[model samples]
Target: MSYVALYRTYRPKYFKDVFGQKVIVQTLQNALLHEKFAHAYIFSGPRGTGKTSIAKIVAKALNCEKAPTAEPCGECAVCLGIDKSSVSDVIEIDAASNNGVDEIRDLRDKVKYAPSVGKYKVYIIDEVHMLTQAAFNALLKTLEEPPKYVVFILATTEVHKVPATILSRCQRFDFKNIDTADIEANIKKIVNKERLKISNEAINAIAITSEGGMRDALSLLDQVVSFTKDEISEEDVYKVSGGLSRRFISELLQTIYQKQPQKALDFLNQVLQDGKDISRMVSDIILALRDVLLDKIREDKKYPELNGLTPPLIYAYLDILNELQQSLKYTTSKRAYLELAIIKMMNHQSIEYVELNQKIDALQKEMHNLETRLRSEVQVKQVESSKNIKVQSKSNLKPLVTVSEISEILNQGDREKKNLLKIGWPSLADYEVPQLRGVAKLLHEGSLEAVGANRMLLVYDDIITAQNMLKKETKEKVLKIINSKKQLIDDYTVLLKADWMILKDDYAYQYNAGISKPKLKEIDLHLYEQDEDSIQEVKLEEDPLVEFAKASFGENLVKVEE
Candidate 1:
């Protein structure tokens, strides 16, 4: 004789009583009518979407005294017993608490017995995703091949957690969120049937808050109904649910649209002072802005307050409010964030100002690109002119010291051995110690090819990596690390590995073996003797005529007897 909750009191006993799941209901009934019912069923979907409810309904339909009928006779003892949870054959287990291997083994043992009362025994396990791996594994064999008269129904909010093996053996049904219109219609029916006086606005508010869950809609309606004896207004729903009213949302948006920043802030402060939730206020504002956007798109003047505002401006308002809604989760000063969000929304520049700024930015970027192109063209012209002049002046200019002369000087003087430059060549690559290993990796492509007191030549396989070393910061770091213990060298000349190879071959051929063989200096030839495999062979067939002309013209053209 106690009052029953609305959700339980009005629970769907027949398939026709359920809403928003016509496909599932039709499919289950067709399977039942043809005697093609699956032995194992898995119901998976979001919480409170009638997954468990549908499973129970299927149980009632299967074991009805009418025998394999799609509709259960609620008057029968078997149907009543299942509805009241008193049936021995129709068992409902909460998997959250009983999810263990031992519990599953006990279940497997009990599944073999025939139904004591009904023709079929049904087991409904809720939250089956909570079952441990061992429990699932133990239940797999029995689920795949249960007794002929036994049926297993598994329900879970997360289907991904269930093993594929169990899923393969069961017929899966996906429950969808109840549509808002469906929820609204269903609530209206309950209101009418209960003979309660509730406004349309209050019913809409409950539907929106339910978020596609029918049970939630009923519970919220029940809560609102309990507090009021007379007609339930929108204010009662907002007050009970800690939500904001449309008037508050409308006034706040009006101040923002009119660009009255201080007035907007004051209004928000007043809402907080009256105990309105910050998050709820933001959500309500978002919904109002969405309606404004819809009206803007439709070109309908449903909301007179949004008549003057453009679509972009309304969208900007929505973006700010939504962003603040997210940022409030991490902050303690919700009121402060909300106020700042309103001021930002109000202070946003008019459409004309925003477009003008965008135009200016685009023009500046174009001008910068033009300047860069002109500067690069000027540098290219300068380089070409310099190269032409060098070609014309090559007959007049002569090296102050030739390679032969340098070789003599290097071989004759004991300074070649005593110079710290020679000793530093071997350790330069290794100098990129662990601390500077990143720079060292870049340097490894090149080695210390030639060393002198004033300068040294380093070769790198990749030109880009070599150029990276030529950067001012990179040059400083390399020199600092190299001379950290002792400053043996002052400056460096970074060269491509190919260029270094050419220079070495030319020096060796002119002074040691190829074109002009000069008298040998007892230099430490060991320092320059390259591995035969490392030396690249040059064939006359591969040379272009210009290179042949240079080689034939002698190292210098017009050899004059002075």
Candidate 2:
């Protein structure tokens, strides 16, 4: 009983003493110094952010016999009475208990009368927003025109809910939540002031747990002080508050970074087995990752907790968490989330999360730069293909084009298909072709040879690929799309022809370092590398065929028999 709560004991007695609302406090101080106090005042902000505290300070300042000033002399008789809650004229009404229209009417009647003892009759209504609409209506007239001796000080957490009619008649002052640094410093001040021995880490835990609320921070400190004798340790602080453990989160993220899903899963299992809720773990991972993101972003702050790791490392850890969050919806398991997150973390090229972010960002910017260049190159290729299409319209009277020309027309397709399937396939599906045209993923590659009108010998390679593409679901999809029956040509097709062998791997052809990639790049570069050296220098010829004839002469070599 001897020890009062830190927030309560440390509650500001004067305007200058109120924390984190300098603007409001200064304005109040100026008002008091000028003897320009408002009839009714509203103080609003988040809880534990000094709304009510400031209101009480204002009440004491106006009524304090020491003279109206921002820094009220706390030793004054009026200030002492307000502090002791024994002031007769200064009524502190809990609107929560007295929220009816009758209460407002009764209060309204009383406001018309003069203060019994003091110069001003101050009404400090906490949670003033709880007043019924009827109560507010009854209070509005009294709020708009109170006697010189009466002052109304309303405090609420929800200023948004307060009626405009009530707000218009009163002076509004808003309070702000304390910052993390301020909270930490205040805790340190208290520890030093009280001669209590607590670790810096414990002080930090209290600060972080407070989350920018001074009252909450004080409460945490109070609990820690009560739990253990005078000296509170960091471990005790953490146990008292089940906040997300940063060490555990970092370790889980490291496993994710390793991409060892099995190991990551095992680690996740341990967390779950530790009696931690998956949702809580997932939420903590997100917050810790958020802190990681903050650490990455607030590079200028040089936060002590974010020391050692660079911005890039923080970002890499953040990126891992971001990836984990993406896959969270697929499975509700905490283990799964942790595993996926850690696995992603493992894949990061940079071991440091901050390094990964910067590198990732740099690489992303570079990739974007590359993409812009690639798109410009592609657009140039597309324009060239468009020109060639017009050119081919005149000189080429042929229905079926050559393999290289087939490659040329494919430039107009979406970048994905062009990059994925490549113009390896001949014609559009259901396109009227010479039967050889539709079989390009095969025919041009020597999988099919023309024998007669509609018959062709399906070669072994084409047979294999077609077999894979025509698998159960694929066959269903193909049958739905093409409306075709397989004409088994070779012994290979007859023996092993169930599904079409569409290569799952886009670079599977390039899997052989020596063979596959070079050929693919050769083709990609060959087809894509068509444009005037200086696009601005090009003169438009009447016949588009002239440009193509020149380009063909350059590299494309349109394979026109003319």
Cα lDDT, all candidates: 0.74, 0.62
lDDT of 1 by residue, 1-562 (tens): 9988888888899998898889989999999888899999999988778888888888888889996888888889999999998889988889999999999999999999999888889999999999999999999999999999999999999999999999999999999989889888988999889999999989988888887888988998899999898899888888788787777777877887677888888887776777888898888888777787777667654466766666667767777877898999999999889888877876656534654666788899998886555433433332223322122232333322234533333233334433555455456556546777666556555676555545556665543465567676777777776677776556565654444444566566665654453443322111121234443443323213233335556646633343
My TM-score estimates for the predictions, one after another, are 0.60, 0.56
* Model 2 misplacement above 4 A: 1-3, 229-231, 261-283, 294-562
Model 2 accuracy (lDDT, Cα):
0.62
**Which of the numbered candidates is closest to the native, going by highest lDDT?**
1
Inter-residue clash pairs, candidate 1: 446-459
Top-scoring candidate (TM-score): 1
For candidate 2, write residues 327-392 as lDDT tens digits.
666776646566555655655455544555667788999988865555444434433443323222
Off by over 4 Å in 1: 297-304, 348-562
